[model samples]
Target: MSIKGLAAKIFAKRIRKRIDTWANNPIKTQQKVFKDLLHTARDTAFGKDHCFKDIKNHKDFVKQVPIRDYEQLRPYVDRVVDGEPDILWPGKPLYFAKTSGTTSGVKYIPLTKASMPTHIKAARNAILCYIAESGKTAFVDGKMIFLQGSPELIEKNGVHVGRLSGIVAHYVPKYLQKNRMPSFETNSIDDWEKKVDAIVEETVDEDMTIISGIPPWVQMYFEKLQHKTGKQIGKLFKNFELFIYGGVNFEPYRVTFEKLIGRKVAGIELYPASEGFFAFQDKQNEKGMLLQLDSGMFYEFVKADTFFDEHPKRLTISDVEVGVNYVMLISSNAGLWAYNIGDTVQFTNTDPYRVVVSGRIKHFISAFGEHVIGKEVEQALKEGAEATGAMIKEFTVAPQINPEASELPYHEWFIEFQEEPLHIENLALQIDNSLRKQNSYYDDLIVGHILRTLKITTVPANGFNEYMKSVGKLGGQNKLPRLSNDRKIADVLTAMTTT
Candidate 1:
């Protein structure tokens, strides 16, 4: 057998063994095992630190550890850059994963050598689960294409500066590496134009079997591919089998992708962040399954309903109820304890821990399944406004579903700009078109020219900044609220519209 095939077999066996253990264990036993793993991780990262020493005796070690967001961890990142061991963990961190944060700022999340295995194992389990679900042995032997960022590691003074994607690519098995497409390692953050060009050039003549990445980037790649090849992507790469995606929701972009590819590519959802690969889509054509890295981190779930109300109930993995939404809390080997990542998800099943992402607990508009979150809407606005040569000073989106039968509800875009409005209607159309192109659901909903129209209202040049200052949130860390669930913001937009 080929080395890749052999490796796959071994990986699959290990995954099956783990799954069997999870399936056979009693609930009490499973809980104990999970707790033990968390304890071990805690000891490994902060055993000697004064802050963690008392954790053993503390009633709420998880709670006392302090729930941290990306901004809270930036200082530790500075420490890593200085070549000092991270305060969060006992030893030196292995790499930093760079990702865009809520404020449109860059965040470098630390990952340690001890924590890396959890990511690798979880990713493998995700693949194995796909195999098991398909019930197919000897599936097509073809190269899998991971549409990842540039593989080049940032460096200082000739030493390797590891990024998460770089570390994964660096440590990947030699056999797999041999068959993989050449990564765009010439730059740190990919030069979008050049990277797209390279991807098109490389794959134009090759038989790409699997494709994976964020939906927007993937769509961009295929669009570029079509432009170069003079044929649709589905026709060029006939051998393609799997379409794995993560870092963003695929539902809005699904119809466009399927239509472009001309077939329903087996989709897998991956839950990976800078810190780690937390979970992935387990079964073929199924929603994501939270593969508990019992050997690496401790997991907790806060019931969604209780989160916003007074007195929230925190549930362990064993306590999770199927079909209920929960905000995930994780204590990982990288030394984050009881960290609330802000993403909310629901348990689809519990036997193997399958889940579907409901939405972000914070920073979102969910009047419908649009699932339009702050980051996404922000990007859409940026792209749309920039395309029209209009620089946006600030903007907010709120669902304005009219209560009256004769009235129509649409997204009221309260926009502030430095430039005079050239054409408000044209700008609004451009924003709507950008959103529709990016999100298929938005396209479908807008097709009949019914439900949720985009209404643009120009505000004073410094309106958003003024609003931010008013809220005591004016700074590098603060961002304009893109999506608001409450009607208060909508009321303000209405007031702005009238005035």
Candidate 2:
């Protein structure tokens, strides 16, 4: 190995040691560290000189610190953008990570110097944990490709600034940054399409090993790469090892990716948003573990069912139960307190705090009294695909409301099959049966024949891509909506469904 490679290995070893020490330490000690961090964050958000003095008493601290959300912090975020010192923190923030928010078109989440360590440490620990679980020391040291949004940071003078990815690019070990692929630094998200096209054109012949990004965007990149090269990406990139994905589920797209890549790529779940890196896939790769940044913010979980209800059960990190679905509520250093971000997840095990993302709270289907989650839909689809000897490249489940009667609601399955299955009808029946078996409410509703019908819409070879592109989302991270409960979904199905 070269001198640089040896040094890289040594550095990785030291980082790994730090992570192991942190992970093995007692939970109580960790919790105390986390609590102290949260208090510090609170002081920074509220005026430090004034707030810091009053926060010495625990009861007084909790009472004085008001719950906050993005809307509440918009003014502070604006101030950060204006380069005002000592607003949220002592110094100017490094840069803002732009994230998609519900009301705000794009929310620029501030990351102060004090808080950047949490993000970096969480990300590093995630990787180290994965290495520890796998018992693999050497990952193929090749180019690491992060399939991300345009790194361009918006400037104060109305001119766009540096790409946040590029800013992160600088922080990465200098050697790795030097060897990393060039980032797309366009001003508009719309321009990303052409930029991605350009990347595909230039990198067709290059060897890429580690790939990271949202699965939908990665899938889109691979599809384009295949189209341009006229050969599967597996043949083009010989040394590809790890596949890191975040922002969505990877189970749905696994088969397609495995086939295209010709290797079983390790899936690393990253829990990063514009806010900061919250958690990441554990070393075991079985589930994602929350990198408890107790210091960064206090964490809370609300039962998924409580979202629409007036009084919902909210659990602190100490109160979380294994296997129960909950929506994450974060009180972060960036000024979000008791905030609901909408994504739903469940803990598989709590000893080490491993969890799997279940679905989005808003994405659940409630038709004929049967509440079906995205995971259940995915499970049914997987079973159906297995039984019918069919490969489902992409799919969606939408409810169809009867025009004559507002009370009547049925389901329509939109599928993109890899090959024409011999018995498509049988496949649809199997999917419906699986759904009925998995969810008792669905079974009861179907038995009553209230939501009786299951209509299948088989699309052309590359129909899913066309659909995603039409919606202005063409990539690995953007999934075809698996469960659409919205009433307009029925109209969309009516127009699109052929049989």
Candidate 3:
């Protein structure tokens, strides 16, 4: 092995041992993080307002700090943005992770010096863990591309502001800098389409081994490569071994990706957000990402079903059980206290605290009380595709309460197919059956004559991409919702079908 590969193997072993220490002592590690976060921020304005001085335990914390989303915490965040010191964390944050919000317009998430390094470390550890478990360090010498936002940052109130991915781009380790692809000039392009084209031109002939991004954008990159070279991605880049993705489930995209690549490759799922780098896939054979119990963040879980209740019970890692969906609340060194990050997760393994990002708390179809979630829909589509040999490019689900022919109301699924099934009706039926099995309420609705089985609305090739483009969210950390309660997206997709 080369010097780089040999070094990676040694480093990977150390990281694996460290991971084991924390993973085995989940509760103790979390308690330490919880104590450290409170103690560090005890003198901040928010700490004083919430009586952090008197808080001694999780019970005291629950009494002192109420759960707050970004909107609810904006009063404090606004002051921080206006250059207020000690408003949330100790002093001002080093940077603000700017992200788009549906109701709140723009959100500036604080990234303190203490918190920023955790993000970098967690991401680095994820790769090291992979190397240790897989025993594959040869890729360390090859070129890798991270499809992400521009690294350019705008300064505001003495704090740099940009997308989280862009901010992370600045922290690439010096050793790997030589192997990272896409020149800085190409990555800084404002337009995603143009940026992607530039990236293709820069790295198409390089020794690319690893690709990382959200699924949609990575799919776009793969498609661009195929269009340019007229070769399957696996053939075009024989060493493209590992796909690292976050922000969405990869199950529904599996068949399409396999078809596009012409072979199966290993993948690593990451559960990261503006709030924190929460979890990462550690083992090659494991089902879920290992939760970061010692990453300077304390976690609380509220049953997602009862999250909005007047007194939803908040449970820690010790109280969590497998297979139950929970809305994760976090108190981190970055100055967020009891903050609801809006994503729901389910523990797949509780012994070492591993979890899968199930769905967003808001991204579901509950128009008729059936309350279908993103996980169910993705799994259903996966099941249907497997049974009927269908390859889907993308899909979304929304309720259709009214029908043009005065038929019974049903859920409308807009699907973009890479390869159509022999019978579209069979695919729909299979998916509906799978969903019915997963959600009892949906089954009851269908049997009680209140609603019919789901109906498929086939979207043309590249239709979803066009929809995202129309909204100016075609790429770069943007993701299409897998489920919506309303017809906003469905209506636009319906119009495309007619035109």
> lDDT: which is higher, 2 or 3?
3
Worst 10 residues of 2 by lDDT: 182-191
Sort by TM-score, top down from the best = 3, 2, 1
Q: Report the C-alpha lDDT of model 2 over 1-499, residue by residue, as the tens digit.
A: 6665555456567766765564455366346654564555554544563364555543444455443466776787677677666566555666676655445766666666666677666665666655555654345357777765555455753323443444454466565664456443421344556766766765676678777777766776888898787777777887776788777767767777877787676767877665556677766445555555443655667788775676565666567888788888775565555566666888876666767777877787886668898888888877877777777677778777663556556777888776546888888898899999988998888888787747687766667666667656665234566777865544544455453
lDDT by residue for model 3 (1-499), tens: 9999999999999989999998999888999998888888999999999898899999999999999999999999999999999989999999999998877999999999989999999988989999998899888889999998889999998999999999999999999899997878888998899999888888778888999999888988999999999999999888988999998999898888888889988888888888899999998898999999988899999999999899899999999999999999999989999999989999999988999999999999998899999999999999999999999889999999998796889999999998999999999999999999999999999999999999999999989999999988888998999999999999999999999
- Per-residue alpha-carbon lDDT of candidate 1 for residues 1-499, written as tens digits (9 for 90 to 100): 5555555666676787776676455365445644554455454423344345445532456545555566665565566556666456666667776655655376666677778787777766767777666644343366666666556777642234554655676666565565466454532334555665776777788878777776655776787787777776778888777787776666546545766787766777888766667677766645556656464566778886577665466677778887777888776777666667777777887776777666677766657556465545655666665667665545678777764577666777787664534787877887777777766776777775566568877776445545555554433213345578656765755554566
Q: Which is the winner by TM-score between candidate 1 and candidate 2?
A: 2
Model 2 CA lDDT for position 296: 68
Model 3 misplacement above 4 A: none
RMSD of each: 9.7, 3.9, 0.9
Error of 1 at 288 (Å): 3.4
Error of 3 at 292 (Å): 0.6
| Backbone N/Cα/C clashes per model | 0, 18, 0
> Lowest lDDT 10-mer window, candidate 1?
471-480
Tell me the whole-model lDDT of each prediction, alpha carbons only. 0.64, 0.66, 0.93
